[model samples]
Target: MNNNCTEVEDPYIRYVMSQRPFGWNFTDPPVFKPYEFEKVDPFYWVSLMEDNWKVAFYAAAIYIVAIFGLQKFMENRAPFELKKPLFVWNLSLGIFSVIGFVRYVPGFMLVLSQPNGFYRSICIKDGMDLPTGYWTLLFAFSKFWELGDTFYIVLRKRRLVFIQYYHHVVTMIVVWIVGPLVEPISRWYTVLNYGVHSLMYPYFALRAIGIRVPVFIANLITFLQLSQMIIGFTVNMTSLYHQQIGNDCIRYPVSIKAFSLVYGSFILLFGKLFYDSVIKSGRRQKEKKLL
Candidate 1:
């Protein structure tokens, strides 16, 4: 299905457009418009969620300090030992992941099915027309539930890596911030991530349940994360380029450069970590065997 607002064009283009598959709406010119009303302040939406931000930040801060402090002070804390509570946590995460994944694949296909324009699927002006916001809101709220991940580690006495812990907490904050603050690409990223997590968290859950999942299967989650980064970068880049050239005729409410940089950097960092942990470790082990 073609998912876009047909742009205003010359008479000849309009004549050709009349023969197109989907009917076109030719009332207004395809000029860029900010999401909010022209008179409304840009900060209004963000301000609505400021209270949520403060709470999330403080909670994240406390967790960070406690996790690190406990790691230093406690020597025997570890996730190696299996327990009933751990099993329950894993099962819960598995269920959540499954639900998340179910929504993601279809959502992704919808976005991918859209034609050339980056913002066409869920543009700032007419987002109501697309289903992106509904999924995004659900995905955003799910982050709050995911805060339990760190709690699981703390209870099990596992060493929470700085990156993983920080990524979790900060991402919760970021997703919440971006949800309503500005126009996001919406369901595209959320679906991809949820689908991956669907598989990933379940793997952890199975392991927690004393089911020895193959190492290769767990590695698939890492691969998915890397793929997500690549796709995310591609999407953001396309959005920025089209906006710059005015080809898409969509005006972003915020700085696409800033968004792209932060998202891109996140993918790069995570990609490096995966390589070091899995690929590099495998290579080193192989080298030792050769020696």
Candidate 2:
């Protein structure tokens, strides 16, 4: 790995040095112009390696404790009460999720319209003047709000599976961190995700609102989640290749690779669980009926 970084000989760097002399000032003179921040090259990224190392440690600590600790405690505890407002809150989010889904379709088409075509999946869209910073900020903030899913699950005394809760919290943090940290090649993942959530949340919302959906529809949603993971993996792989080959596509950096690996693995694991719980169980039930 090249540890060498381009020394900031740009006028901006000199001005920055004049102010702080240490090259790490976060105040006035640096003027927070949108997109004015220096392009984060991979080599310079390691400079943050030490400072941000705590994020991983904290993530791991939370995952271990939550999986082994709070989950076990909750499992053995007395059954908790289910109330009305929580349902109402979930319904509201369901509404927002649907709205988010509508936005995703157009956003995705915008991505597809690029000269590289949809399959190529470039992060920085060409010929598309779509909202960049604000959209990213919204997506990041939405992940935080998604923490409500877990809160509701706990409050209603649902069995919080390790797969479910861990994925939610960790993903919430990951999405938040990655959105601004690395300008990924395919923003379509965000849009596709919103689309899935749109359908998924409404299903939850319907359940909360006391509307029974066919079991098949729920299964279908799970299938979509798996499909989303496949698409994401494909896109990330394309981005990785294009980056390495110097195809002018945006590079996803090391952190993105780590994030995608974890995310994709979890999705695959969850898909297996869903298959076991749904299809395998159904087959077993049919066998019992025949007997």
**Candidate no. 1 TM-score:** 0.70
Estimate TM-scores for all models. Answer: 0.70, 0.70
Give a tens-digit lDDT track for model 2, residues 1-291: 222224544442333223321211222121123233332242233234322434544654665565456546677676555546666766677676665555435545654666766543454534222233224345655765665566556645677777776676666656644543334443666777777877887787678767899988888888888787777777777777776776765544654575577558867776797788778978998999999
| lDDT values for all models | 0.58, 0.57
lDDT of 1 at 75: 60
lDDT per residue for candidate 1 within 125-160, as digits (tens), equals 332221233344557667777777776676667666
Q: Which parts of model 1 are misplaced by more than 4 Å?
A: 1-51, 72-82, 117-119, 122-133, 182-184, 249-258, 288-291
